[model samples]
Target chain A: MTEATFDACIQAILKGDKQGLRDIYDAYLDYIYRIVYGVVGSREDAEDITSEFFIKLWQQADRYKAGSGHKAYLATIARNMAIDHTRKYKKEVLESFTQESDDDVVIEPVSSDNTEAEVIEDIAIKEAIGKLNPKEQQIINMKILSEMTFQEISDILKCPMGTVTWRYREAIKKLRRYGYYEES
Target chain B: MKNLEKEYKDQIDREVPDLWSRIEAGVDAYEAEKKAAGTAPSSTPVTETPTNITPIRKKNVISIITRITAVAACVLILAATVKVTQRTKSESAAPAADAAMSEMPQNTNEPENIQHAEEASEATEAPDYISPITEAEADAEPSNSYKPIAGADSDKNASPSLSPSESAVIKDPVTFDDARDDLLPQLEALGFKLIKDFVFEDSVDKRSLSDDVISDDIDIRVASFTDSKTSDKYYVVYTVNDDGAADILIVRKADNTGDILYTNPSYKNK
Candidate 1:
């Protein structure tokens, strides 16, 4: 839904309109679910987190400001909730991470005649990313996959913006060494 | 800032979408459970007062009650004072009259005269004492008053003291339930569904008040629920006091009833 429409729905819900809540769920559930999935890295975990996110929305619906993008605000809430879940269930999350192999982490290559080349490129990049320290790997992933700005990455990782820039440079240097990118 | 850094940034951006999609799916699953449990179709009205009361006729009813109590107290006090004064006068006058008669030249047959004078004084003083009380009551009547007692004395030649709007608010509490019930069908016809039934309470903060005037009314609160599945919408119900104006607020869900996305107010009802 358009931001204007989403805002209207939020106002309705804040006013204690049940239909507004239902409408919001039906309209933007996929977009919100996707954001939660991105952070939690598991369908089951994402589903659970998404549900919690909605409940939080209902509880705090009145706090939403009209002009602010509702989707972005909700995404931030979902990300925070997912992080909280990860912290609470750290052991399970770590086990799940260890079980998933490099191949499991990589996306299935699209049907192109150059699929083998793309797969090789993905493998090389993934291995190079894996070789970095965990914090460096997170910085790279958040910048690249999450499309977060340097400032946003710094905020998310609880580091300075300069540190985020330095980390990305180091990760990119490692990727280049692994033949994942051309050296300039 | 370097050339190599620039090259890598381009590559990362090109490859990010696929990875992001996988990450997003994982988050969706995690949130679904919480959303299911929290979105239990509550029928409570949402309000700033925390009492789930849709702002309506509660204020009017409270004002009427206050007016009635104030008027009743004034009437009672005046009546009691008049009764006490009459009793004391009769008690003192009996002795004084007997003393005066004792001083008179042996008029032993004056008992009939004394009885007739007592009766005549009582008949004259009763109306005189009551007239002022009635006039004071009329003068003390509330501005824009709507008390039903005003109507009760109409045929008895009492003044028409209540304004139209005041009477409407006073009479509203009795008809409020029926009026609200009757509107349910109209609300349903307008596409509202009933959800969970719950009572709401409002709290008063003394520190939040700037004035010393305290309210003594207890607010009665209720909630109604409805969903627009086809439009993927939900509405919060509210009714205004003047003209019984009804409003429904719209909300949309994020995914599978997991999260609710509040569409901005500007886009609602369109």
Candidate 2:
């Protein structure tokens, strides 16, 4: 969202208006969801955390400083919340959820009646992303889907900007090698 | 690359379920919990009416209690005055009656009455006694007043026991190194030890009155030490005069006021 619009939404949230929170959630849900999904690597867990992320935003709306970059603020909070969730739950729980989703994906029928171009593209992209490691996937999601700058990603990751750019370059190279990029 | 990014964003958007309902429910629950705890800011006005009515009842009960206390106080004052008058009359009449009267209350009631009267008179006279000191304090308050608060960290730096004249300044002009060597022993003799030596060039910007302390053309060195005996911090400024002799200046760093104690007349330094 634009800075002015975000500030207005924050003012409304501070005044205990639910519509303000809804406006923020509507504007940034896809961006926040992608960042959370990137870190947790599970759709169910991402949805749950993304839901909690808005609740946190509603609760901490007063902490939003005016004229500070809102996208970076949201990205930092979302990334930290996702990391906290992963640390709170054991590795085996997340793995079991991923394994169950993978089993569902394998068993689902892709017949001519139900198969569409978008579904096929979605499945193809999902499988291509599945091949990339979690770090590379996180960088790709933050860099492309959330439209975050390398400096912001580095700040949230607490690493050097050069390392962030290098990792993003490596992830893009790996995606290209996987034939995920379409040639013009 | 743009097409691939667009595809990924669209897929994630399709996958992320709408959570506005859950969020609204959570917000409602949070507001409800805060309202139950009486901490909800928006609900405070609604709750204030009932709270405002109960204080009226409490005020009545408090006033009644205060009236009873005032009556008891008046009765006690009358009893003390009557006893004081009786003791005066009996003491003037006969010394034998004074011994009998002192033994009558087991000597407790007389002393307690006298103590209560003294305490009441002191309480009424306290403002009169403190007013002169308060005026003096107000007059001295304009300049950085040296009164250190009790139990404050600044108490470590403010030594009320040591007068400013007690701070030692080397009288004769000596070489910079020689003066510094002698200055440490002199201050140590006065119960001070070296804390740190600060570079003169770096500390020039730190002092507000740098131009008054030393001329820019002169070479100088600065060292700080604390008087362990009096808990005062002192800074020794060693400056080489045009005659090839160093003039020493001692400044008190007590409470960061940077008050100069003694300056040498040989140099244009304060």
Q: Name the candidate that leads on DockQ.
A: 2
- In order of appearance, the predictions have TM-scores of 0.32, 0.41
Q: Taking the tens digit of each residue's C-alpha lDDT, what string does model 1 give over B1-270?
A: 223334444444343222233323433443354335433223234433433232234655777999999999999999999978864654344433323223211232333433333233333233221121122333454222222343355432232343434434432323445545533433332223332331121242321221111111111122323343233322222222223422212122212442221111211121
* Candidate 2 per-residue C-alpha lDDT over A95-176 given as tens digits, one digit per residue, 9 for 90 to 100: 4333432224222343453322223332456677767766667778767765667886666555556656766766655555
DockQ of every candidate: 0.07, 0.21
Instruction: For model 1, report DockQ.
Output: 0.07
User: Under CAPRI classification, how is model 1 graded?
Assistant: incorrect
Chain A only: TM-score per candidate:
0.56, 0.64
State which candidate has the highest TM-score. 2
Q: How does candidate 1 score on lDDT?
A: 0.45
The C-alpha stretches of model 1 lying farther than 4 A from their native spots are A15-19, A22-44, A83-133, A145-147, A173-184, B1-270
Candidate 1: residue A156 Cα off by (Å): 4.5
